[model samples]
Target: MIKNHLSQVFYCFIITIILVFNSCKDKINSENQTKTEQTEVSKTVYASSVIPFFDQWKLILGDGSNAGIATEFENKDFFYTQNDGKDNWVVFKSPNGGDTHGTSNNTRTELAQTKKWYPKTANDKLSATLKVMNVSATGDATVAASHSVVVGQIHSADAFENEPLKIFYKKYPGHTKGSVFWHYEINTAGDDNAKRWDYSSAVWGNDFSVVGSDVSTFPEEPKEGIELGEEFSYQVVVKDGIMNLTFTSPNHETKTFTKNLLLSEYTTKSDIPEQTKKLFFPIGQDGVERSEAYAGEGCFFKLGCYNQTNGKSPEVNKNWCSGAETHGGDIQKQYADGNYAEVWFKTGSISVSDTAVSNDGYFAKND
Candidate 1:
């Protein structure tokens, strides 16, 4: 009996030791896994990657001292000027328009246009960031109508044959007060008016001129409204002619849209509007006609702006007013000339912050 009791005690001691060892091993493994995830998430583009593009332009703008002119830089080709005074905000022609624009207090530096590179052929990967800041607005505004942004290609001097892997964001301005809506359109190589597409337009065919279908799919409009003074972030990927768009709010709520497309489907010879067609090519010495004479010359990128509909009566003026009285109306147009469109190889992955606003009103690191 004594021998049996001693053996039983020994067995119990061994079982307890085994249980404790297993528990400790499990805890260590879990901790290591968590550490690995954190390291992976921290790898996003820092200020260093973005600063060089704007540095030279900032020096020319004199740190935003001038008040009446809004200067803009292209990829080293054409410069754009807009009347940026109190009530006359118009884009004019300035000799040094591509010099400098505005300075951000965060880095205390001037801001310049970030050039986007288009691949030589289809199926090439292309990515870019379009940063929009509300410089001076008393009330909260939502980005309403769908605006177009140009990617690859050179000048509108030629036919836009090479289709781009395009991606853009859609803003939903539901019924919320002070909410704004923004739409994005992506154009490939072609005449200005020929390549333009709008999100609000219906998706009919694979025509490059038709909105959404030529580049990538846009998200469904939101039923509920987003509040005013709110900031939104969008990330997009275009790989091998496949495009994907993702949207995230300050709260980290995310949504994604993906589609597969062929480059040939978008190349069509449809009858486009005279104004739209003119936008396809550069304004030459005799600035008004569609100059297919300069075909294959390459087209650069351009950014278009539109107003959103607030519940307020149409009497309430909401359109973004500018000084270029000659071509003033619904679309606020800005173009980047071709010479500056240089290509750069991106090394690591890019991760942007959910909110562009920092405590001090500057772009903050992604939270």
Candidate 2:
């Protein structure tokens, strides 16, 4: 009987020890999982994380300042990451009524990457997948914004005040359709901004030159246009002085365009517009146009929401008045109330190499 009692006690003791050991191990694992969650929440997702060749680019915020050299993942307020239940996205936002870079009333949260190339530089490409969310709503409805936001730009880094390309998305109020257009800003021969004007081209609808005379009017609706939240992509390939653009959509047709950046088509007096002739005639800018164009200028690329909206009312000037509403520079309220521009990019790449880049996603599974 004594032996039996001792044996039972021994079995109970062994079981008690085993249970305690298992419980502690489970607690440790639980703590570790919690820590992992917190860590992920602390870190920000970056364009480099989502796109290929992120190291080759740098970010510039709306205030005409560099976000950084692109080493850090994010800038606190101007640039950051957001997840919309399906995927993580890099958000570029800027206010309508704000300070701007030279010769621009609009502000931008954009990324710029310089390439060692001239006007006739070839085999350089920049591509991205993105969508534009909102633009300024208080401007003249008859102007470009009845609804419009600039989504992409190709700017010259040299002293020439020229932009090789500017991509625009515009929609009218109380409509579901919108248009996509691009413009090539003329290199005004010298630093004379008064003699500058852009040559507009159409991708999905009317070009930059198509606009209503007054704030209450709007251009014709684009028969085939992309709506807000619709995902689209654009690829810019500069080869031998010709800029070849390819725009794609999941449900829409894929379109391509080509332009010559080496030669200036608007180099003569007749090329000057009647509007610039009337307005700038007093300034004596009618006889000046870029003779060689953007040739040999070290041009750069910029991508982001360059808010086309301004504080001026449509009643003020149909051309410059975005007449959109403003929230007194309150970024939080503006973001929440849809008073600003927001753009998202899933993936992008810049290939300076002469070889073609593959379409494979480097961080496809990271989401």
RMSD of each: 20.1, 7.8
lDDT by residue (178-240, candidate 2, tens digit) is 778887777776656765655666787666556665665766767788777778899998887
lDDT of 2: 0.69
Give the runs in model 1 whose Cα sits over 4 Å from its true position. 1-116, 119-196, 200-223, 259-367
Per-residue CA lDDT of model 1 for 140-208, tens digit only, reads 222121221112211121233222222222232232222222222334433444334322211111112
Looking at model 1, report the run of 10 residues with the lowest lDDT sum.
358-367
Per-candidate local distance difference test: 0.27, 0.69
Q: Which residue pairs of candidate 2 clash?
A: 137-324, 138-323, 138-324, 138-325, 139-322, 139-323, 139-324
**lDDT of predicted model 1:** 0.27
Find the candidate with the highest TM-score and give its number: 2
Q: Estimate each model's TM-score.
A: 0.31, 0.77
Off by over 4 Å in 2: 1-44, 75-77, 84-86, 272-288, 313-318, 353-367
Top-lDDT structure, candidate number:
2
Query: lDDT at 218 for candidate 1?
Result: 37
